[model samples]
Target chain A: MTPESNPILIGSQRVRVELIDRPIDRRPLSDFIRDPDTGAQAWFEGVTRRMTGSQQTDRLEYEAFTPMATRQLQELAAQAMDAFSLTAVAITHRLGVVPIGEASILIGCSAAHRKGPLAALPWLMDQIKADVAIWKREHFAGGQSQWVHPQ
Target chain B: MNCQVLLFAAARDLANSERIDVEVPPPVTAAAVLDGLGRQVPRLLPLLPACRLAVDQAFVPADFPVSAGSELALIPPVSGG
Candidate 1:
């Protein structure tokens, strides 16, 4: 499914999850998950770093099984919301080539207290890295490229 | 039964193709298709044991029953930010 076709559901709270082919914007996502009653909000941005195991990376090419990746991401958001008692949660991960210093993934959550959002962000990130149907190929400056796999 | 297995990431690179079709005997299973893939593309054998299998978008075990028209994918250990 395309990015625009992605859904944002609302019931007890809002949950937005998407797989985009462009850059990730943190502010809009942060605002999307904001709630009037929320006492705190947490935002996490994952950027493409320039180094990997002594190799200098110029950029990263991300590929995803779009349909499955989108489904997994939505499931992750729902799990985070339920597990952490979050009022709102949003996750957006970028596809295609991402240059060093560019944000490749954005995760935001809101809760009535700080601890919930704080703990959920990292947990969600780990889940995304481990379970999501996405892959990254690091392109090094020396014309070498390698696929990165989760440990 | 005939089935197609989709490859991704390292599995894709190793197989040198996006998808592979295999014909199996009755009582088809994900493991059967994976075995056929290993025979057709020897390079995929090293990654097969570690890779996960997904049938119609959900992860399934190696012995999970598969049908002729099922959508399958080989998911290597993922690394996403």
Candidate 2:
């Protein structure tokens, strides 16, 4: 079953932030960001790559300090909306073991113009990587797993 | 004073437990809790400096007072994209 979550509204944007234990559906956010006046909608989906340098990664395990992470994500969404003048944002990250080629994260953004949505999507992702309290462990083909984090 | 030290990710791996209770002098501080934790689990000593301390879900400074029964999470470097 999909992990439990609720939509959050900040400013004019309806943000979907969740720490799910199952696969993330891209459709919901796509539908949420639909707008006739909005000329640009940018979506980003991060998937588990099969290879990491010379090592082949079979899967990735994710864990989260949920409450703090959720709080930080909401702050990020609100900041993104204010910073880039975005109309909507939706983000979902997966927990538990995710096999190769599956979506580990999904970020969607919409704006009245292309510039705001385009700029906000990638910036939002970078902020999540740097600030969120989530972790990733890569399981290699040699049956060894390594915990990965940013310096 | 007593506070619950919660471990996550690499900190959890190093300590081999998700939670550890620590006792400190009156008016416990986050640094004292870290010192106490390092003393109890020597393996955590090297990693403690890099870990971020959060009390009751808010990240706090080393000198931040840890209230009784509060949960302190040790958040190591994060890489979530």
Candidate 3:
């Protein structure tokens, strides 16, 4: 099935979880909003950072147990769709080594009213971090790297 | 019965072997396989606390049963976005 047919909104969106190595398009957000006849589409893009606390970070690497991870992410999206009155949702995440200032995750949601999608955006992000099977490894400037868990 | 156990991520890198053959009694459970693995590959003991197991590509908790010819994978903590 196409991404539009099974659009992912909150949990690790379709683009991020299924298309791990491909680049994501921003147009999906606009398209979803248009299709839903909504007045507003709230979007959030999580970018890689150059610094972590006092230490300078070189890059971030991500690895996943592909099959199980994808299943878990899809389940999350379905849950969000049922909980919130959403018209359409799009989510994308990048795997492998992501450089600083690059988008790692993109989430968009459309609803009849602005308040629902707006409030649900952050809540969805939190659920993704907490329940998703993805993991993040931070590489420091001095060649030290550490795995970071969702908090 | 002899079955092959697959390792991934940090556990694979540490063991230096993708698959190992272990002998177990018939109708073994996933937990029993892990116990046998620890005895055969002592190095895996330290990493067990942080690892998970999968059967036939699905995550199975310790109590899950194992059948002969089942594919088992040792999954370390994942680090993906």
State the lDDT of candidate 3 residue by residue for A70-146, as single tens digits.
Answer: 66766655666567776666666767778888877787777777887787678778776654556677889999887
Model 2 segments more than 4 A misplaced = A1-4, A9-13
- Return the lDDT, model 1, position B69: 71
Each model's RMSD to truth, in Å?
2.0, 2.0, 5.0
lDDT of 2 at A38: 89
Which candidate order results from sorting by lDDT in descending order? 1, 2, 3
* lDDT tens readout by residue for model 3, B1-81: 787988755566568897888886756887888888888889988877666677877778787888877888776665444
Candidate 2 clash pair list = none
A1-151: candidate 2 lDDT, tens digit per residue:
3233455556555776888888888888788888787889988889999987888998999888888888889889888988999888888889889999999899999889989988998898888888788889999988998888666
Q: Of 1 and 3, which scores higher on TM-score?
A: 1
- Per-candidate DockQ values are 0.85, 0.82, 0.36
- Tell me how far the alpha carbon of residue A13 in candidate 1 is from the true structure, in angstroms, after superposition: 4.8
State, as a TM-score between 0 and 1, how close model 2 is to the true structure: 0.92
**Which regions of candidate 3 are displaced past 4 Å?**
A1-17, A32-34, A146-151, B1-6, B17-27, B69-71
State interface RMSD in Å for all models.
1.0, 1.0, 3.5
- Across residues A1-151, which tens digit of lDDT does each residue of candidate 1 receive? 2233265564665888887888887777877987789999998989999976788999998989888988888888888888999999988888889999999998889999999999999999989888899999999999989888755
